[model samples]
Target: DTAVSQTPKYLVTQMGNDKSIKCEQNLGHDTMYWYKQDSKKFLKIMFSYNNKELIINETVPNRFSPKSPDKAHLNLHINSLELGDSAVYFCASSQLKGTDLYEQYFGPGTRLTVT
Candidate 1:
């Protein structure tokens, strides 16, 4: 079974439109994160949820928000999308183990194209 899954692998929307991406993890991970990858493929953490609580809210735009209904699900909603928001958004989940602290399973990624 896939550990992490995201809906709408490819998203195409116009600027100023609001969109959302849903993510679910079946791995029973305590931590889940949303990341944005720019055109340069540089990944930056956006929001993180640990055990249904907001843990890390990085330096992201105010238009973006993350919502977690439970430990196994995290969703990202973007408002007033801009061309700059055109990039790949990734959802990842992990269980913190002393040895594999940074180990995470990522979804295939949602490609957002704003025009």
Candidate 2:
């Protein structure tokens, strides 16, 4: 079984379109995250959810939203998509085992292209 999975691996749309990507994890981890990989291959954390409460990174825009319906699922919604928003979105799950140790497992990623 896949530890983490994302649906609609590829998305192609025009600017101003709204889209959502769904992610599911079977690893039983309490913390899940959404990351965006830019054209320069810089991966940045957009949001983090621990037990369904959101902890969004300050740099992320309000147009991006992350929802975790449960511990095993995290979904990302983007409103009024822009060309600069085109990037690979990754879903990850990590467990806080001890004081400050965490091992994150990432999904394949969903590539979104906006025209």
Candidate 3:
């Protein structure tokens, strides 16, 4: 079984449109995260939710929002999509082990294209 899954594996939308991507995890992890990988393959964490509480990364714009309905699910909402927003979005979950160590597992990823 897949530990993490994301809906709408591919999203193609026009600039200025709004879209949302849903993610679910069965790993029983306490922390979940949303990451964006640019065309250059540089991955950056957008947001993180620990037990359903939001922790936004400073570099992520306000146009992107992450909502966690529960510990097992985290959704991402993007308002006013732009060409720069085209990237692969990945959903990940992690469990904190002893002494600040963490092991994170990632979903297949959702590819978003903005035209």
Candidate 4:
């Protein structure tokens, strides 16, 4: 079983288009997050959900939204996608409290390209 799965590992689309990226995790963890890694390899946390509740949200554009139907799934939808959004999007998860450690396991990542 996959710990985390994201569809369409690579996506290429024209600017101003709309797209959605699906993600799921089977780790039975309480917290899940979405992070966007820039071309420079800097990872920025975008959204975090705990048991279908939005917890952490960074300063992201309104065009981007995160949906978590259940504890195992978190999806990202983008409107008016821009070239600046062309980066690797990663889905991660971790426990809210455990082992005195805050470790996050990341998915392989979905590479989105806006043309």
| Candidate that would win on lDDT | 1
Our model 1 lands, by Cα RMSD against the true structure, at 1.0
Model 3 bad stretches (over 4 Å): 99-101
The parts of candidate 4 lying over 4 Å away from their true place are 99-101
Question: What 10-residue stretch in candidate 2 is worst by lDDT?
Answer: 94-103
> Which model, 3 or 4, shows the larger TM-score?
4
Provide the lDDT at 47 for model 4. 95
Model 4 TM-score (2 dp): 0.95
Q: What is the C-alpha lDDT of each candidate?
A: 0.93, 0.91, 0.91, 0.93
What would you estimate as the lDDT of candidate 4?
0.93
What tens digits encode model 1's per-residue C-alpha lDDT throughout 1-115? 9889999899999999999999999988889999999999999989889898998998899999899999999999999999999999999998866755489889999999999
> In model 2, which runs have C-alpha deviations exceeding 4 angstroms?
99-101
Q: Which structure is stronger by TM-score: 1 or 2?
A: 1
- lDDT for 5 in candidate 1 is 97
